[model samples]
Target: MGIEGLVAKGAGTRYVGGRRDWQKIRHRHSREIIVGGVLGPITRPDAVIAGQYDAGGNLIIVGRTGTLSPSQSAQLATLLSPAQAGHSWPDEISAYPWSGRDAARPLTKVEPNVVVEVAVDTATQGRQSRHLMRYLRIRPDLTPADVDQLQL
Candidate 1:
């Protein structure tokens, strides 16, 4: 069965519910805001907000609403594929369903603790989206260089 199918079976009908609070901002890497792969003279996040999944089987990630340039849109697409690549943490933790989040409870903390690297065809100021976000669970034994070398 597909991963989604498995998650659905495990999740039943619970949703995490938290998509409307995300702070959206432009793509800010360092001090430069990139839009259409071009560096903007100023530096600032296009938008920022707190977002979470909804209660009705929909993952609603909301932030400041802004138009994404073609380049930015492309970059965003890459994130989707990675976002679906879910894994467990704690090494010994058994993969099990949770209240929400695909019915599979992520073993470690969802943010920071877990790092996902996604490939970007191009980036824009508001949101550099090319595809889907690829999920990458950090290995405690791996060095920074080891992780850096692997790009989405």
Candidate 2:
């Protein structure tokens, strides 16, 4: 079977309406993506939106990182400059599902130079993460091109 393993519960424990007595731990996935943009104010960002290049050399929107720490936000501010004219993924940003129906805040696009490793639980439409990814760390050694070489 493709299943990695299984979890077991107590023999007499019956399914209750409240929280389950047993817990199942599933494998979580992680990937490295390029920092393409950010949501919320530029100085103190809410999340680190990221992307990766496909085989065709198109920068595909992958996902955004979870809420950043004050230090992390300040550090990112130093590395990320405002995207120049004719930024890539304009349409993608406008149509991004995570923005929600009543999104008022505009996304601040950053140069896709910074690379970060993030942990994701699920993916949507095989393109982006199903939810905001957990930010692991910034990768100074890796470039955006390195994302294509990754096995994931």
Candidate 3:
């Protein structure tokens, strides 16, 4: 797993800023760690697992990885709550970069050079349901919008 590779290389911790910088890279490079490219689509028949930490240090576990039983899903949800509970910045990762409550919009823009796939377990629709819980990956090519179109 990417986390294992990062640890092997002596990377003690990773941040969302690392993700932003990786997106700007020309090609996927892994001197010390493997990284985001291995992760697959959220709706792929085969799944990928991933996690992200928001500013407050809340770890959000995401991606299908495989079919999750209800109990497992709940456990995962609990693990990810810190991110949800501690997100004070409305625009840290949201469609509205400035923040005005258009949560349905894509949080990160998928550049042509970078293909990042994001895996999400469920999507809820509502005024408050703006951002989707996602496990992001830097694939060859990917778009957050496609996740919304997945046939469940």
Candidate 4:
């Protein structure tokens, strides 16, 4: 017989809660993006934000890395330097079209010279990824231009 499953729910349930009410699970997808900058304080970064270059060569914000460990944060802090004047994507860090309360948080733009691979689950909306991404690792051998070769 074909596979089967059961979904238990309270009687008269009307979607009155969160994901706990759902019976289905979703899989995540992965991709590589250029590290455009880091968000939060330099001493302890909250997340690593990344982007991809479009056909027009514009560095478009793709997504931000998820919660990083202390060691990861410290290591990133050492590798990244504060973006100086005339930085590429000058307003990108502050002008990110964050939704809800996220817009209120500060973003520290860094040199967009690092490349990283990340695992993301959601679909892309406009130029941004729809979900928070997990940082898989840094691609020391890869350059920002290599992102175009990735299938996504």
Candidate 5:
């Protein structure tokens, strides 16, 4: 079967039979995204600022990941480098996930070299994801080019 998975409703919710009601639970999906920047110091980024490339080779800012553990942050730091001159993205971006975005969180630019796999909600389209992406892992085998034109 092609079913992805089921979502658990919040606490204090009674099961109701279908009776003319409309509800949508955005399912999670894994996708490859380019690391356009970070939310903290490059040496130890708190989260990844995800992005994807357009047909013209320009990077588009997608959603970001949640805070990484010390080890997870260290693991990602090893593969990241500061963005070089003429980098596609700006030095910082205020963009945040639709659900949990902090007004004080910072965005630091990085070389779009690291490719990561993340789980995002289904409400997102190519431009960006509406929810915070759950970081899966670094994809050493795939390059940013491989994520080109991918739908969010």
Candidate 6:
């Protein structure tokens, strides 16, 4: 199920503030995504804008990574470069669409060739994850073509 998790409640149980009376039991999923674009600079990305190719061979924005650790940033820097002309994605994207925030910022388009791993909850809106994602590591052994394409 594409649900966050299951909650098991005791019969006739009264709600408590912080007693672990009910278990959230969130489901975290690890997935492989293409590095489409990024926040901050090409040399040191603050976060990653992940993507997955739909059945139409079009890249769909999937999710955003939380702030990158210095080590992660450095590792990504070695793999990413400025997207060439006629890139599949735009130069920037509105934050409001995915972030639910008022401020929109510029996104640095990347080559869309790097494949990396990320951790996300089961919360998804359309083709995109609706929650913050954790960047796990670069999958150097895998290519973008090896990433799973969306069913669409």
Which candidate leads the pack in lDDT? 6
> Residue by residue across 1-152, what tens digits does model 4's lDDT show?
22223456678775655567746433565677887777778778878878787766767677777788888888777767777776566443532443434344566777777787888765566767666788887787887777863223
Clashes of each: 47, 0, 2, 0, 0, 0
Location of the lowest summed lDDT over 10 successive residues in candidate 5: 1-10
Q: RMSD for each model, in Å, please?
A: 19.8, 3.8, 18.1, 5.4, 5.2, 3.0
lDDT of the structure predicted as candidate 6:
0.88
Q: lDDT of each structure?
A: 0.24, 0.73, 0.27, 0.69, 0.79, 0.88
Q: TM-scores of all models?
A: 0.18, 0.75, 0.20, 0.73, 0.77, 0.85
Give candidate 6's error at residue 30 in angstroms: 0.8
Q: How far is candidate 4 from the true structure (C-alpha RMSD, Å)?
A: 5.4
lDDT-based ranking: 6, 5, 2, 4, 3, 1
Compare candidates 2 and 5 on TM-score and give the better one: 5
The TM-score of predicted model 6 comes to: 0.85
- The parts of candidate 1 lying over 4 Å away from their true place are 1-109, 135-152
Candidate number with the higher TM-score (1 or 6)? 6
Error of 6 at 114 (Å): 0.6
Q: Answer with 5 or 6, whichever has the higher TM-score.
A: 6
Clashes of 3: 2
Q: Best TM-score goes to which candidate?
A: 6
Which pairs clash (backbone N, Cα, C closer than 3 Å) in model 2? Answer: none
Tens-place lDDT per residue, model 1, 1-152, is 11111122233544556743333333322111111111111122121111222344222222122333445434433322222233221212211111113332222112212222332223422322322222222234432223322122
The model with the greater lDDT, 1 or 6, is 6
Residue 113, candidate 3: C-alpha displacement in angstroms? 4.5
**Tens-place lDDT digits, model 6, residues 91-149:** 67777655688677788999999999999888877878877789999999999999998
